[model samples]
Target: MQTIGKIASVGAVAVAAAFSLTACGGDDTAAQPAAAPPAPSSSAAQAAQPEGRECTADDVKTTGNFGQAPTITIPDDCDPPKKLITKDLVAGTGSGAKAGQQLSMNYTLVTWSDKQKLDSSFDRGEPFSLHLGAGEVIPGWDQGLVGIKQGGRRLLIIPPDLGYGQGGNGIKANETLVFVTDAVAVPTDKS
Candidate 1:
C-alpha cells in the first residue's frame, strides 16, 4: 500500500484478503487511543497508532465468523464521538437484524488483511442491531460503540485478539480488522 502521509493504501493481496485500513482523518481523531499497539488492541481511544499484522485478502473465515469488521479512515483532524447512535432499534430492521432492544445500524465490512469489501447493508439500505456492551457483536464494536450519539457514522479496527484470533474466520484470521458503519438508531426495551 502506498502511504498517503500516515495512512497507506495497502497492496492488492492485502486488499484481496481481509484488510485493516486505518486513517488519521476527520473529527474522529479524538476517538483514537494513545498507545496504539501492533495487533494488540489497546483501550478504546481516538487516533490509533497502529501496529501488528495487517489483514490480507486471505484472512476471512466463515465457520467462526462472528461479525463483519470494517476499516475506518479519519481525517487528519477528527473529533471523538464522530457520530453517536441514539435511536430506538427494532427487530429485522433489515436482514440479520434483531429488533426493539439494541441499536440498529447499516454498514459495510472489509477484511483488514486484504482490504476486500465484505458486506454493505447501507448499499442494501438495511440496519443491524446491538445491545451496546452486551457482547452481541465483537469486543471492539461492543466497546468502541458506546457514548456515541444516535444516527452516527463510525469506523472501527478490531484485532484478531479482540476478534476471531489465529484460527481465522475462513478468510480472516491472525489479523486485525476494519469496519465502517452507520448507526441508524439505539434499541428500545424488547419487553
Candidate 2:
C-alpha cells in the first residue's frame, strides 16, 4: 500500500508538470528575464510587412489601439498558413523587440478553420508578458514577433508546427492559430 501511494504521488506530479508546460508553450526550457527589444531597421520593417503573397489583407482585418487588443476578423473561407506569417499593421515609433526581453502585450487568439474566438487578454482586463525568443510563448509568437517595435500591432498566422502541433490544447489537433498582438511595453531592465 505504501508503494502504491508513492507511485500515485509521482504520477500526479508528472501530470501537473506536463500541464504547466503545455500552458506556457509546451517547452521544458526556462527563460531568463531581460530588457527591451532592439531598435528597428527600415529594411527589416519592410520585409516583415504583409505583401499579399503568403498572407493577404482580404484574409484578415484588424483595427484598434497600439497597446491594446485589436478586433480581428477572419473570413469563413480563410486559408491557413503552411509557415509562420507576420504582418505589422501599425508600425511602432521605437526600437524593435529583441530576443530574451520580457514583452508586455495585449492579444486575441482565434482559430482559422472556423474563425472561432479562443482567447483574449483584453477580456481579462490585463495584458500578459512573455520572454521574447526564449520559447516562453509559442514558436510562432517567438519567431513572428522578432522585428516588432514597441507600441506596434501585428497579426500572426501560426501553422501547426509552430503552434500546438499534433497534440493540441483541447481546441483541436494540428490547429492553426491567428493572433492580433500589441507590444505594449518592453521594460529596459537588463538586471
Best by lDDT: 2
Q: For residues 25-112, what per-residue lDDT tens digits would candidate 1 score against the true structure?
A: 1223211112323463344333343444433322322211113333433222322221222222212232222322466655555545
Clashes of 1: 78
For residues 51-168, could you state the per-residue lDDT of candidate 2 as single tens digits? 4444454478877877665777875443466887788888975777889888877777776654677777777666766677654555677788887887788898878767655432
TM-score of 1: 0.45
Best prediction by TM-score: 2
Structural similarity to truth (TM-score) of each candidate: 0.45, 0.67
lDDT of each: 0.39, 0.60
TM-score of 2: 0.67
> How well does candidate 1 score on lDDT at residue 159?
57
Stretches off by above 4 angstroms in model 1 are 1-101, 167-170, 187-191
Q: RMSD of candidate 2 to the true fold?
A: 14.1
